[model samples]
Target: MSPVAGTVLAVLLSLVSAAGYALAAVAQARLAASAAPAGRGALRALLARGQWWWAVGLNAAGALAHVAALHYGPLTLVQPLGALTLVAALPLGAYCARRRVTRTEWRGALLTLGGLVGLVAMTGPAEPGEALSLREALIVAAATGLLIAALASGRVPRRRGDTGTRGLGHATASGIASGVGSALTQTLTAALALELPGREPVWWQTALLAVLISGFAVGGLLLSQAAYRGGLAAPLAVVNLSNPAAAAIIGVALLGETFRAGTWGWPIAAAASLVAARGVVLLTKGGAPAPEADPASSTVVVTGSRPVPPPRATELPAPLPAPLSTPLPLTVPLSVPEVEPARASIPG
Candidate 1:
């Protein structure tokens, strides 16, 4: 087929893949909610579903289409199209789930797409390549290990003061994991040349690729579900920006991919990405109300509204002998007390 036709096919496949991912995310969210004791296991259940199979299957199909596109058209064309998933997924999720896509979400999505398109258009096509040598591989291993350690250590502990912090912490952690998974997948894909399936293909490469794909597929699915549960904008921001940013950084630093456009292009792209990310954060934070300062206090206020007296403080009370001496006369009223109006106003 002609290069143009191949490129078109690739773009279409990319959209399909995005749809798969979006569907997977929605399905995972539902499973997580329904599966008692929501956790990683819900994600597993999500992936186990027939719908998930379709999602993953479409993803694979898109990957193949992408590979074909690489053969025919410029990488510049195909890579940017991958970001189309955001545009596709949001609308699809809204339609399928009856979820509302807020104006902020739409804005963020558009900005993200525009920035990606601008960046891809400005940068030249990528030259297909393979993994680094053992030395470089070691360096990457060390870096990834350090990142993992940091991730582990960076827990937002649920302390005495605030439970709300816990949600943010979880979302951030999930976002990081999803982002890292995306970055690694990109790296793994580049290193392994995923399409080269043969009888004697390198087992390590194949194994690593499988792990990466599974990790990303599962992590992304779960994280997105969590995002919707927590609030969509924050997680979406992290996944969308981090995936491309990580890939771009690695592509430039490791793969030696060069930006052919004037020096302004890269910086402009970066700036736009930052803006889009900030917009997402703002939108999410705006939607989620701040937690009450003291949960206990709020509880007290709720219970206090009843005519019942507040619970006795868990402290020793004065002896009963002293309480018996405090007999007081009670006065009874013949009628309910009347409330006096401050001022009289004419009816409208």
Candidate 2:
């Protein structure tokens, strides 16, 4: 296909991928909100929900589209486009979940997407590098596992009222695991295709990569489910940003990739990262725990069309005088006058 045609195909596929991801995120968020709290049986409960299954299917479709996009376009072009997932998710959440998208959330999502796209765009493409050796893969996997454990070990915030701090942590961990999984997937694919220089594919290494990939994929999914319980926008932003950021770091460290703008690019990336962090803070602020009702405050009773406030302390009727502790003295004189002798005398 011509370059233009291929680019167009890549863009379209990327858009489709974004849409799928956004829909899945909305579904998962709704499930997390409505389903029973996370526990030992949480996964089982999620599995029982048809919505969760639909989410999983959508995610799989998105992943496939992402891969196809990569096939048709350069990573520099395609990876930045992945940020559109967040853009798509905001409206989908508002519409699908019947949740209002606050202005803060919209601004945060945009900032995150802009920062992430900018960050990834600064990463120039590197020549294809050799796949990870078993030792390298093990090292990466171990490090990633440690990071995920640390992030996931924190106490989860309450599902009903929280600032999403714990959810953000979980989301970060999920992103890392997923990013590493993607990296491993690439390595495995290269090995399977015999793209590694001067080396025949090793069966054990391939098997190990597959195992690692599966482990990370499952781990990320579970973490993401937990993360959404706090709310959608902030945690989703964290996950989306962290996923690409982690992968880019891995690409640079292990895959011989470098920044496009060299020394100057680092500062720009840092600034973008700061902007993204600000955005996340804004999102979390937007999800501030709903104010608890004050018990001492006057209650408002809705009557007909208007709210009627309960009587103020001053307006309340005085309590009836307490009943007498002792019976009252007889109203009659204690010693009544003796009654006069009756009319017997007159009869006589």
Candidate 3:
């Protein structure tokens, strides 16, 4: 295929992938909203739902498309396009969840996407590098696990109105897990592709890598499911931005990749990151306004334009002493001589 044709194919596949992911996110968000709260039984409940399975299927399709896109085009070109997932998710989520996309949310989504795309564009193409050794992989995996636990542990109790914060934490963890999974996948692929004479690929090492990959992937998926329960746009934006950023960091640290613009790129990347963070903050702020208490159920009621506090227990009048069951007899008796005295005086 010509370069142009391959590039076109890659772009198209990336778009398809983005659309699939966006749809899946919406489906998951809907399911999470209705699903039981996160616990030991939550995963089982999610699995029982047909909609959740549909979301999984969609995600699988997206992953396959993403791999195909990578096959057709360079990472530099394809990775930036993946940011379109957030772009697609915003409207799709709004439509699917029956929520309005606010101006702040739109701005947040755009900022996140722009910053992420800028970050990816600044990254230079990766050169061939040594596959991560088992020891290195284990270390990375252990560290990632710790980070995930920290993020997902909910060590600090959340308020009823803090679902957005909870979701953001979970989404961030999900992104890290996913990014690590991708890095491991790349390592495994590189290891398999190595053509060293007289040395067979170690079976145990390959098995370990596969296991690690699966673990991270499953972990990421569950965290993402938890994330969507809060709301859609903010969590989705966070996940999309964090995923590539995490992967890029790993790529630079372990995969021998570097920034395209060298020394100057750091500041630009930092600025972009700040912009993206600001966007995420805006999106989070826009999360379904902490659900208003039902007026009917509230102690305060609105009369015309003013809120009236319910009558307090102290404000109620004391009940009159219970009515007497029967009338009481008179206690004092009258004297009988008064009439006789009057009569005697008249006769005299």
- At residue 61, candidate 3 shows an lDDT of 97
In candidate 1, what residue range of length 10 has the lowest lDDT sum?
A: 334-343
lDDT of 3 by residue, 1-348 (tens): 999999999999999999999999989888877838565877787788899899999999999999999999998888888889888888887777577888888898889888888888877756655556666677899999999999888642356666655578899999999999987887788667763122545988778889999999999998998888778888888888888888888778876778888998888888889988988888877765767686555676566767665665765554334333323432223334666788889968
Candidate 1 Cα misplacement greater than 4 A, ranges: 38-72, 121-126, 152-228, 282-348
Clashes of each: 0, 0, 0
Candidate 1 local lDDT, residue 210: 58
Models, CA RMSD each? 11.5, 7.3, 6.7
For candidate 1, write residues 13-62 as lDDT tens digits: 66665555555555544443354445567656665677656645654565
Q: What is candidate 3's CA lDDT for residue 117?
A: 85
For lDDT, the strongest prediction is 2
TM-score of candidate 2 to 2 decimals: 0.83
| Per-residue lDDT of candidate 2, residues 1-348 (tens digit) | 999999999999999998998899888888988949556887777889899899999999999999999999988788888888888888887887566778888888888887888888887654665566656778999999999999989987555456556588899999999999988887788778887544676898788889999999989988998898787888899998899888889878977888888999899989989989988888887755576776667667775767666666876554334344334555345435433334445666
Give the TM-score of each candidate.
Answer: 0.62, 0.83, 0.83
Q: Rate the local accuracy (lDDT) of all candidates.
A: 0.55, 0.83, 0.82
**Model 2: CA > 4 A from native:** 159-163, 197-201, 287-289, 299-348
